[model samples]
Target: MEIVVSISDMKVTSRAKDVIVTHALGSCLGLAAYDPVAGVAGLIHCLLPLARDSKAPQKNPAMYVNTGVPQMMRAMFGRGATRENLILKAAGCGRMMHISNQFDTGANNFAALQKLLQVNEMHLSAEDVGGTIPRTMRLFADTGRLVISSCGRSWEL
Candidate 1:
């Protein structure tokens, strides 16, 4: 099975398949976590930086990185994944635009996610972030492998 995730969303692919997430990312971010032993992989598309701005956590929780990361992890765990065994990696957070735009959503998004990860006692192992180009990220669940392609270049994470 293959799955594709949209912006500000997340998806967990089955152990027997691969997952792909795409699109133009300016300030948005993409996160992919996998448990190699269990063959479970998850992908999150974060639009903004943090979940702190919202008064209501449940409504539109995907809009914030803080809320979105945890939600994605919970969903993956529901499918029989262990937190300690999972390998976390991130991409996007591209500054395709400039930071002068109001609050600098791109930088804020990355900072928010980093803070959230710190609070959760988790840290990212691999990252391809903070560039001026967009990316297409793919995760292979069977092998717990990740591939990121951008600007005619590709790499494994």
Candidate 2:
């Protein structure tokens, strides 16, 4: 089964036949984590760096990197994924047009994610981030393979 993780959303699964994916990653963050031994995988697409900056109280914690990442991690752990065995990968965080450098949402989003991971003693095993093009990210639950695609090119992260 293929599970689509939309913008500001996440999905976690332990099913061996599942493939989790997220698309249209421009200025957004696509994060994937998998535990090979546990046969568990998760993917999260975060739109902003922080929930505190939202105009109103955000109902969906997955909408912001600060909240979303932790939420996704918890879900993965609940599904039998362990922090030590988790292989983390990331994609997206592109500098899109019409978005000024002063408010570089992509850069900020990545930075926030980095900070959060560091605080939790976690780190990304691989990543394909920062550019002007949008991307799509996919994670295979059975093998913990992360593939990132952009501009007609696709590669493992």
Candidate 3:
């Protein structure tokens, strides 16, 4: 079965047959982590770069890159996925539109995610990020395969 991770959301599973996917990633970012040895995988869709701006963490911790990525990682680790064995992949961080380009939210989101990953001692094994077009990201739990697609073209990582 396939699990759709919505914006400001995440999902983790150990089932080999499960596929975690997030669609229409424009300026927003998609972060994925997988552990092939444990057969565990997770996907997070983060909208902004920080959660500190929001007073209510319980209301939506998944809305920010800072909070969401680690939350999802914890979920993956709780399911037997080791930090050292985790393979990270990221996508999105697009310009998306020419109008209203004052703040590059995508770039900021991606940068914050990178910092968070580094602080966690995690590294990205693969990535498909930054463009004007939108994208879709998928993580296959069964084999820890990540596929990113855009403009009718797909790349496996």
Candidate 4:
């Protein structure tokens, strides 16, 4: 089974048959956390860096990196996954616009997610981020295989 995580959404599962996936990651971030021992996995598709401007966080915490990352982690932890055992990985955060002086949401999104992981005492093992191309991310629950795809190629993060 393939579970799609839309923008500002998240999902966690321990079923080996489920594969969590998220797409259209331009100027957005995809976060994946998995516990190999417990066979639990989660994925978050965050659209922004912060949630201070609106009530989106209160309603859908997965809309911002600040809240989404930790929220996704907790969902995984609830499925017999330990905080320390969680393997964190991220993708996307692409530079979609050519203007250098722009706000650069992708960079901000990456930085915010990094801070969140650091604050949670989580170690990010790998990532494929920061480019001028959009990408799709996936998490295989059975094997905890995280992959990022772009430009007609794909690699494990």
Scored by lDDT, the top model is 2
User: Model 3, residue 147: displacement in angstroms?
Assistant: 1.1
Q: What is the lDDT of residue 54 in candidate 1?
A: 51
lDDT value, residue 20 of candidate 3: 94
Clashing residue pairs for model 1: 49-109
lDDT of 1 at 61: 64
lDDT of 3 by residue, 114-157 (tens): 89887877789887778788999988888888898888999897
lDDT of 1 by residue, 20-107 (tens): 5655656788888888777778888889876665574587666678888889889889888888988998888877755466677777
Residue 114 C-alpha lDDT in model 1: 89
Q: Which ten residues in a row have the lowest lDDT in candidate 3?
A: 94-103
The RMSD of every model to the true structure, in order and in angstroms, is: 1.9, 1.7, 1.4, 1.2
Question: Which portions of model 1 miss their true places by more than 4 Å?
Answer: 52-57, 99-102
Across 31-75, the per-residue lDDT of candidate 4 in tens digits comes to: 898899999999999999999966778998999998888787777
**Residue 35 displacement in candidate 3 (angstroms):** 0.7
* Cα-based lDDT for every prediction: 0.80, 0.91, 0.87, 0.88
- Give the C-alpha lDDT of model 1: 0.80
